[model samples]
Target: MTPAIITKDLTKKFGDFTAVNGINFEAARGEIFGFLGPNGSGKTTTIRMMLGLLPPTAGEIQALGISVKGNQAELQQRVGYMSQRFSLYNDLTVQQNLQFYGAAYGLNKVDLKNRIQDALAMAGLEGRENAKTKDLSGGWRQRLALSTAILHRPELIFLDEPTAGVDPISRRAFWDLLYQLVADGVTVFVTTHYMDEAEHCHDLAFIQRGNIIARGSPARIKETMMDGQVLEISTSDAIKTVKVLRAAQKAGKIPLKEVELYGSLVHVVAPNIEKKINDIQAILKKAEIRTEQMAVIEASLEDVFIASMK
Candidate 1:
């Protein structure tokens, strides 16, 4: 069976600069594919190429079993898209907004109304269908954006940082909607900078400087990038310990990224964690520092991304 989305060496260039530099990627049917990257990593450009909104300078993109370049109209009909910072008519009621977009997509009045209801319910905005868009909060607006994007029941959805700047609750709700879509066999391809949000994806493609640096299930990706163990140090001297280690290691160009402070604990990412563990003990002994606890643990997805990006 054809992948829901496929792009081989897909590229985009602007005069002397290349935005998306020969990136290859694929998304499985009914799967959630995340494009994780920082700002200006050419994620948006790649998405545009995949959606056929912009022509690629090189390579090809196939979506829903059709070449993006040759079958853009049909592809668009089968795919839903929600862009970052998208604007809907501020004055339009939710129902009116849905109806207008539904008609534009050529949905018959009856089907359009039913889909509108379904989208609203999926977005948790059923009762607010008559509310003005501007009256909604940031979270509600995001839900509305999602509702509008999937109003036509497209086979796949492309979201560009859909949860950026939203509250955690809103982000969670959005993921719930994504899960529902997956259950219904609709694929999700999304790009986001938020690591916490990226963790929610089933699988992720890490993009760096327009290239895919890593692609796998989040857990697998995390494990692949880390060889040594992560030590979690919890004590009254967490900050003091971090300061001592960082200062001591900075001169040697230690691989330690930073002393990530987690509540009352300090997570130390290092090579030969057992050696580091012994070293930490020696330093704390010398510094007369006391810790409530210390243990080695697995690295997180954030650790993997940081290591890969570096």
Candidate 2:
């Protein structure tokens, strides 16, 4: 089957600066494809080019098997986009917003009525249709935005950091809705900074400095990108531990590849971490920091991302 989205050397430049530099990837049909990266990593630039909102300086993009160059209007009708801001008319009632969007998409009166109801149900706002959009919680607003974006039943949807500020629970719920869409054959292309969210995608690409550094299934990225094993160290002071370890590494005291603080734990990455565990413990002991536990653990997406960045 043809991929839902494809790009080759997709690049964007703003005069002297390059926002997206020679990126290439594909999103399969009916799958959640994640564009993972830090802020200012050109993820949004790539999305805008794919959506035909911004013209690329060079390279090509084919979305849903249609060239994105001059066929923007035609493509717009078949694709949905939920921007980072969760575009909605806050002053309008829930139903009113849906009605407006449905009409904007050129839905007929009867189709608009039916799709509004479906969107309301999908957003879990059945009884809150008359409620002003501003009165809804962030989670509710997010769902409402998604509902409006897909009111036309488009074949593909582009979501730019859809869960950025929402709480974890709400983010999970939003992803549940994404899964439901995929189950119904809709393709999802999303960009996110959350490592956990990246794990949920069927495939992902990590972008940095306007370039794609890694792209693959989560498992594949972990297996292929990680050059070292991760060793999780439980300590009373994670922040201090990270500082100390980083200092030691900078001074060539330890051969660790990466040292980062994860909540109350410190993760140290290195090739064959088991052999260096004793040295790690000795270093912490010298600093009067007690090591509660240490074990080799599976590398997380964040770990792989950091390693890839290096």
Candidate 3:
């Protein structure tokens, strides 16, 4: 089957500045594809071009087996979009918002009614239909917005940082809904900056400064992009541990790839670091920083992401 989305050498520019520069990739049918990047990394610009909202300066795009340029009217009916900003009216009730979007999608009265119920149940907003959209919690409002976007049963959906400000529990709940959609044969193209969320995607493209630095599944990226082994250290003070390790690396006391603080722990990356464990211990011991624990551990996606950026 043809991929759900295809872009070849896609490029977008605003005057002399290039927002998305010659990026290329494909999102497969019925799979979640994550576009991972930091802020100002051209993720939104690329999505707009794929949706035909912004014309690309170069290259071609095909969505759902159809060209996006001249067939926008037909494509709009087959795809859904939930933007970074809220798209629903604050003053409208939950049911009212769904009704409005359904009508905009040209759903007939009979089909609209059934689809509305399905949407309400899917969003867990059946009894809250009469509540004002502004009165809902951030999580509830996000779910409602997602429900509205999918009311017309589009085959493909584009979500732009859908879980940005929501709490962790709510973000997990929202991802559950996305999993359900994929199981029902919907293609999800989501962009997010969260590394943990990127792990949930079937495949991913890591973008930085309008360039794709790496592309693969979480496991593949970690295996291929990570430059060396990771040494996890638990010390009395994480900040002090990082400072000492970095100083040691700069002074030629030990060879290390990267030293960063991870929560309360310190992670040091280097090649064949196991052979230098004693040297690391001796340095920390001299610094009077107690080494509670230290071991070589597997590299995480966040580790690979940070290394790739450097």
Candidate 4:
């Protein structure tokens, strides 16, 4: 089957800086493709290039099996985009906003009416059609924005940090909506900073400093990119434990690849961490830090991503 989106050596530059270096990836139809990256890592730039809103300095992008270059108008009609910021009119009523977007996408009056009703139902705003968009909560606004973006039912949708500021429950709910879209054969390309959200994607690409440092399914990335096993240490002072462990690694006292603090726990990654587990506990104990519990645990997407960033 043809891929929903494809890019080869896709690149973008701004005079002295390259926002996106040569990066290659593909998104299959009816799948959630997560583009993960930190701020200024070219995720947004790449999305803009794919949407044909910004021209790439070099390379090619094929979205929906059509070349994005010189075919933006054609592509625009077939794809929907929800930008990082809210794109709907805050002053408009919920139904009005949906109507405007439906019309903007050239939906006929009859189709618009049906789509408006669907959008209202999808957003759980059936009786709140007359409510001002500005008065809705962040979660409601996010759902409304999504409903509006899909008002025309495009084949593919690009969502840039769609759940950024929403609460965890809302984020989960938004992802539920995405799964529903995929079940209905809509392809989703989303860029996000949430590691949990990344885990939900069918496939993922981690970009940093304009380069794709890692790419694969969540399981594959954890298996391939993690060079060492993770040792989860429940400690009294995670921050200070990390500092001590980092210093030990740097000073050649401990052979650890990464040391990070996860809440009250300290995670240390190293090859054969079990062999050095005793040494780790001894080192922390000598520093007067109590090691409550220690165990080898599975590598998480966050662990792999931080390692990749380094």
Candidate 5:
């Protein structure tokens, strides 16, 4: 079967600066494909080109088996987009917002009514229809946005950082809705910086300054991209631990691939890290940074992502 979205050397530029440079990837039908990167990493640029909102400087974009540049009007009818920011009207009531967008998608009265009911139920906003959109919490608003985007039953959806400001519970709930969409045979092409959320995707492409450095499943990327094991160190001070380890690495005291802070803990990445545990402990001990615990742990997607960027 043809992929849901396919790009070959897809390039976009603004003046002389290339925002998305010769990037290629494919999102299979009925799957969640994640585009992972930090801010200003060409994620939004690529999405815009795919949606035909921005024309590419070069190369091709075939979404749902049609050329995005040539057949935008038809593609718009077959695809949905939930932008990075909330695009709904704040003063409008939930019912009013849905009704407006549904009509804008060209739904007639009867189908619009039925689809509005489905969207409200999907968003869990049944009783809140009369409530103003601005009155809803961040999570509620995000769900409503997703509901509005899909009111047309598009074959593919583009979500640009859909869960940015929401809480963890809400993020998880929103992902549940995405899972339902996939189960129902809708292709989801989502862009996110959250590694935990990236883990949930079936496939991913890691972008940096417009280039795709890594592309694969979460497990495959971790398995192939990381050249060493990650030694997790729980120290008295995360900042100090990273500083000391980084100094030691720079001064040739330890053969470290990367020293990074993960919340309150420090992770040291290197080949055969188990053999250098004593050296690591000794350096921290000399620096008066107490090592509460040290263990060689599995590398996470974030670890692989950081490694790839370096």
Candidate 6:
């Protein structure tokens, strides 16, 4: 199958600064492709160019087998989009908002009514059809936003941090909707700050400083970072122990990728970690420290992201 989205030498600039440097990639149909990166990494810029919302300084964009160069009008109808910020009309009733958008899409009165009801049902806002948009809570607002985006069941969806700042419960519910979409063959391209969210995608695009550093299954990303194991050392002196681990890792005494401090605990990222645990304990002992506990564990995607960003 042809990729759902494609780009080549995709680049964008803002006067003196290059927001998105030469980048290229493809997202297969029905795949939940994640765009991951730190702030100012140009993920948003690239997405805008793909959607034909922002013209790229230079490059080619293909969406659903159609060139986006000047056919954006034909392409927009088949793609759903939700931005990082809420885009619904706060003053309108839920039903009214849905109706307005439905009409804009050229749905007839009967079809529009049915589509509104379907959207409300899918978003779990069935009983709030007459409620004003502003009266709903944050989670409800999110549901409405999602409901509106998929109101037309666009073939492809672009969600930019759709769950950011949402509580874990709401985030999970939002992800569940995405799962249903993919099941129905609707491709989703999403960007998010939450690693747990990214882990749900079929594949991830990890970018930094305008570069696509990694792209693969979440499991692959985590495994690629697992050149070694990670161990946590809990002690009363977090500062001292963390300092020692950092210096050790830097000086080659510890063959670890990173050392991070969390309160009274120091996490060491290393390979052949079993052999170094006792050695680390010895070093801690020299500092007149008492260890509370030490254990080995798998590294988190967050850890890999930090290491990658470094």
* CA-lDDT, candidates in order: 0.83, 0.92, 0.94, 0.92, 0.94, 0.86
TM-score of each: 0.92, 0.98, 0.98, 0.98, 0.98, 0.93
Q: What is the C-alpha RMSD of each candidate to the true structure, in Å?
A: 2.1, 0.9, 1.0, 0.9, 0.8, 2.0
By lDDT, who's the top model here? 5
Over the stretch 197-247, how does candidate 4's per-residue lDDT look in tens digits? 999999999999899999889999999999999999998888989999998
What would the per-residue lDDT of candidate 5 be over residues 114-150, giving only the tens digit for each residue?
A: 9999999988889999999999999999999999999
Off by over 4 Å in 1: 237-240, 253-264, 284-289
> Which candidate would rank higher by lDDT, 2 or 5?
5
TM-score for predicted model 2 compared with the true structure? 0.98
Model 2 residue pairs with clashes: none
TM-score, predicted candidate 6 vs. hidden true structure: 0.93
- lDDT ranking from best candidate downward: 5, 3, 2, 4, 6, 1
Candidate 4, residue 172: lDDT? 88
> Which pairs of residues have clashing backbones in candidate 6?
none
Best of the two (4, 5) by TM-score: 5
Local error of candidate 6 at 237, Å? 5.2
Which of the two candidates, 1 or 5, achieves a greater lDDT against the reference?
A: 5
Candidate 4: lDDT of 2?
Answer: 82
- Model 5 RMSD to the real structure? 0.8
| Candidate 6 lDDT score relative to the true structure | 0.86
User: Candidate 1 on 185-242: residue-level lDDT in tens?
Assistant: 9999998877877788888999888888898888888877775667888876777887
Candidate 3 weakest ten by summed lDDT: 301-310
Candidate 6 lDDT tens digits, 1-310: 7899988988888998898888888999998999999999998888888889999999898999898889988877898888889688999999888888888777898888888988988888999999999998888888888888888889999998888888999989988988988999999999999998888889888899888888788989888856677788899688888887777767887577778874467778777889898889888888777889999877777777877788
List the candidate 4 regions with Cα displacement exceeding 4 Å: none
Candidate 5 deviant stretches above 4 angstroms: none
Clashes of each: 0, 0, 0, 0, 0, 0
3 versus 5: better lDDT goes to? 5
> How well does candidate 6 score on lDDT at residue 84?
81
